[model samples]
Target chain A: MTRASISSPKPALVAAAAALSTICLALAPFVVREGDLRLMIEIFAVFTFAQSWNFLAGYVGLMSFGQQLFIGLGAYFVFLISGKAGINPFLLLPLSFVFCAAFAAVCAPFVFRLRDAYFAISIWVIAEVVRMFISQKDWLGSVSGLPLVATRGMDRTVVANTTFYFVAALALISVFGLYALSRSRMGLALAAVRDNEGSAAAVGINVWWTRFFGFVLGSGLAGIAGATYYMSVFHVEPGGAFDPNWMVIMLFIVIIGGVGTIEGPIIGTTIYFLFRAWFAGTGNLYLMLLGAAAVVTMLVAPKGIWGVLRSRLGFELFGTRRLGPTNHRSSP
Target chain B: MPPVLQADRLSRRFGQIVVADELSFSVDHGQCLGIIGPNGAGKTSVFNMLAGVIRAQSGHILLNGADVTTKAQHERTRLGIGRTYQVPQPFGQLTAFENVLTAASFGGGRRGQDAADHAASILDRTGLSKRSDMPAGALPLLDRKRLELARALALSPRLLLLDEIAGGLTEAEVNVLVDLIAAIKPTLAIVWIEHVTHAVSAVADNVVAINFGKKIAEGTPAAVMADAAVQEVYMGAVMDVAAVG
Candidate 1:
């Protein structure tokens, strides 16, 4: 039986569900008020960052504890270009991608040399090194950080900028786009390599090339996230830019949502933000509760929240494109 | 004549313990060669050297009489060498068809719909037509073996290397595997390193036996199986199978 004819919900039904989600988001600002609107935009930023992290760790079998290195650097690059150099902030976004990609290219050989846990720890060390170096920069505001704008009056447009930025974030997220990209030929190669590197090489795959491309692409996305996140926050510093809390948030999202599929990040980010709102007044108890919940979820649903839902529904919300019918037979 | 693939004086060492030593062998075009050996006799090392995953300590490897000793694994694959592992390894998350599609696209240099068709046909030939859309990890033992064959075949290899694919299968499964190997014989040369004596004998045109990284016998399967030294190395196990003769 082909997936196309597998008695799934009608396209209209799926479209209606998507339309409802869009409508909900569109009306959220009016119903939830300004503070909640700003919070929701922040949540979208977190989702973008987490999904990129999920792409690297979940699909590539890479655990990068130092993703903040790129995210922080991208934030700083945009802050420097826009705040100090007086360039339009939007122009500085793509420039951050280029800079982060170049850095990954230079660092690929060195970082790729390390295996497993060593690779994870090495990346974390690299991030700390970068953070410390930036912390010592007097002109860049050192530990105190820098204002994202030179004057108070120009910054009055922050609300509109944040709103427009959220729209752009949602557009770029485009779950279907990510799903299509991840199901392409390159994605298959990456999945094979991730499953078994030695076998992948034996079958004529360039394992290194597959992994390096995934790493670089993932880093670029993280950088883009950092740039946009800085605009949302309206400031940049070593502490805020290199916040390990963002890493914690991302890991929780991927772990709680589902690491490998596109839906995981979306589902994860929504659940995470909801929990945050529910427990905001609990102080350290909130963080402790999140930690306990993450551990419990991982233990109970190791594939993450999306995996649970997919299993229950017998659906692949995120999957490859269909060109024609598939001839699937049961093995005897 | 220049052989289609030639490995001269190939050697491998793991810090003083030699796995392969000064081994020289050649596979001519459209020739099926069987390699038999005791456990850990380094038959897979030869395959690894030919496929370019591990470099030989000192040797010249020529593909179609052109040196490819230092080429990368993917480059060697593009040049028409494909291999299956002793233990079949398929992408657990991908469907069997998707796994083969990757081989067609990246290894065989095809693209899009053509690559998909190439993969599907390869799967059909390998008896995996029914399980194409099933996740590879969910497939049974025999299907997993077929997935490995399908993956290698999807590359449209000029030289196909099989590594102990029948090692753990039942006698019946071995027979099915042998038939499949025989069916593909006309189009591609095969180098099958197998532990299952009968299966190798059933398919190989010629057989070479190795002991301690050195060739012990080379000839027809029946002749090699009957050789005193070849029988001696099997440590009396072949004596029981001798009744089949």
Candidate 2:
């Protein structure tokens, strides 16, 4: 009854690293410009969003392209309820998560019935449907969208500071949430399903139900990111609300970093930001560069940056808490 | 003891071909039943139907006298019906231990610590305790077969369905497997489809010969192998000398 134990340097070290990184980031406001800090907040939020997508696509093999549907819902719900309904935006953020998660749960049965490529396309279509529907709505600001007409509980300066703090908090939570999920039994189920659905069933795991749960949980995380983003931006238009570009950006982050690992998205997002800053003045060139980079990454380093680091140097920026390909090897 | 598995008038057809035509059989508790057939005999198809991988067009399968004809594959597994594929398809990304652990958790319905213990025990029983940390996909042919058996054992099945478990092994490997299976025979009923006659004869209490999906002969392994109809069915198909050796 002795289970095989792969070498792991305690979860405490990983937790410490996460805490240290968070503290360093929280104190970043003193040395950094407001613009750079804003970008960092955006990147952290976006990194979480991307990692959520990766959890479904990479680990569970859900391959959902309609994650923006929940993202837009997260952004729009917080905008409407807090900005227009005149509620304390920060307090209302959890509500957005509930709403978005509920929406994903309701839609899961229908969308999950479609297998592989069709499932991916169905999510995309659903997001577009939501976007088009919002574009035609009157109270929610049709094509032009709506702005936060009134500020509730705080002035502009305080709101900016609070919003940055909220973004940083949510990002940390996202990392922890992903860490917890990947380490748990659910994460093991997802990896099994991703590897072989038939074998998973033979082992008595309900593949469809596990995948649906992962999809919903991931969408809930995206919903949290969307809510925090809405508070900072203070606006929601249909075009901006359900941005297709956001999906591509998230996908890129995960692929560049490492698909199924926690640090993959973080590393990918950091590299993406550096590139984005360098190429911002070149207009469409940034998109082209990223596209080319993605193609090259897929061809050359299909495992991505974390994959390379792990294989070459036995590196783990985030603690090893989950079952993955690495867990299969017998070490000396 | 009551029959561990009973298939009542299981019938299925594919256009003009009847794969399982009113096939009825029962395996008693702690019995080992070996199924033999020439190529295209639908032996695997029968295992598939019993495991709930493929639904029978008509008829019912009862485990412990409870009908489970309409249950899903995972449901059947949860009900303690574990099976191994002929090709040995273990989860490629998982270590041999994890593969068995998943089976322990889901099929055996054990919780956290209990599941791990069950998985480790299953691995040990299958002679895979040493190679537990190796990825299933990376294991050698014999080890892969061991892992497949270990995975099924993890479910702690009341009835284990094995499809061609010894089809691709050396004679020495087959002997090793036969001994392993012999040791586990007292615990559960097993229905194994095999081309290797020695492995089947070594462990099975009963043998059934199938052709075109119907039972051609059924009795003790020696008696069934000696049946004229069974001989005609496997004539020139399998060398008798090679099987005995």
Candidate 3:
């Protein structure tokens, strides 16, 4: 057999892009204003959420409308551990993630039983049930919610900056982690499963387990984002934590940015925040505009904005290379 | 030696329509068995059962003498049963190389560089090396068929199941596929379900005919094709002129 070399065409460019983003985010604490830090945190939170959703819907073809389940669970976990148990709020991130992962694992067998639209709705129903259950729990302070009491004694600037850094790290991890995954064997399996489950099975991919993994990972990330959000805000409520609007915004970002590509979520989230900032005073009109924009993006470029730009420019910053001869030789 | 695959009294029904009834068949190691039947004759159903895509109400599917009737489709593939669909379904967003590489790694149980090497060879053999970088969904029909075959072959299976791979192909393209299959047949057992009689006749050592979920004829390709019951089943059916002539 002839030797074949498979290398990404623009590895340097991808590396430079990664380095640049890291540098900018790392220096954000010194350069960014306190108010702007809050906005940056919001961007990071939504970025992580969109990344999680994109992993599920884009790579696994598991369209979910109840990702808020994990987000809420993360917040509640932080509250239960830090707010009630008095653990340091910063140390609660891992606990929140693990709890959300366990919750997802338990939900998998039941949710996997449903397909497509039913699966989406079933997940939403599960989130609602969780919210309602949490609302009635007296230890969680009932529907009134709980505050991050652990952060009460800390300096306001120190708490805000630390939380800001955590959120930024999460955003980086979500993007780079997904990028690395999309280049792995498991990532190939994910794409296979997404494209055609029947064909994926025929090729020996465990379709159920692959989707389950995606579900768990996506949920865990969403949980972390949720925990960070509530930690920064110093409070968590069932209503705010489990809001379905989280999923709505995530879907809009993913759809407008690009559904299946790594670049989509970042681009989508950036566009989303820009629009939100520009229309901050418009209230409900802002949401309407976002919805309209998503509809227009879908109709105009179903692959999303990143997808459109990638196709038109013929460049992929994080695209995985095909594993075969790069030099195209004519067939025999 | 144990047969590569055996289906014992396999039966299935879709409400009122019986797709397979007591369908028993076996193919030895390095043998090529061709299955021919008219439309809705349960030919694809048998392939589905063998591939574990559909369950049989009552039957045993054995791979190398081990019962696999309870196995899931992916498990069946891992157990050395690789198959292609009638309508080829390749991963649309992935490049052809990625599609085959996925199977080579996951189905063939290779990893890392080994999987890449295996996938590369398969792509070259399938005449898709030049088109390996193209998204599979963009491939022309003939190339798509080749991709299906390449993906199935990536499993490095003990038994290969091909469904209508020669359909929607020019005579020359069919010939190319026939030669490809023939080249690889020496090392693997093959069960080919095809409406293209000439393609089947050219490559299959044995032929089986079925209609209404029952095996109507089985023997050497020439004998089965000439069987009276086989002719009767094909007569008045649209496939009759194409299959029998």
Highest DockQ among the candidates is held by which one? 3
The TM-score obtained by model 2 is: 0.93
Write candidate 3's Cα lDDT for B93-199 as tens digits.
Answer: 88998889889889899988788888888888999988988889999999999999999999999999999999989989999999999999999999999888878
Calculate model 3's interface RMSD in Å. 1.4
Point to the candidate with the largest lDDT. Answer: 3
- Pairs with steric clashes in candidate 3: none
Return the TM-score for candidate 3, rounded to 2 decimals: 0.96
TM-score for each prediction? 0.92, 0.93, 0.96
Candidate 2 lDDT tens digits, A150-251: 455467766777778877877787677677666667777887898888888888989878877888888888887887886677777889768889888988
Ranking by DockQ: 3, 2, 1
Runs of candidate 3 with Cα error greater than 4 angstroms are A328-332, B238-245
For candidate 3, give the lDDT of residue B139: 97
**Candidate 2 Cα misplacement greater than 4 A, ranges:** A1-7, A25-33, A150-153, A319-332, B241-245
Question: In order, what fnat does every candidate score?
Answer: 0.47, 0.52, 0.74
Name the docking class for model 3: medium
How many Å off is the CA of A61 in candidate 2? 1.6
Better of 2 and 3 by DockQ: 3
- Candidate 2 C-alpha error for residue A223, in Å: 2.0
- Write down the lDDT of every candidate, Cα atoms only: 0.78, 0.82, 0.88
- The CAPRI class of candidate 1 is acceptable
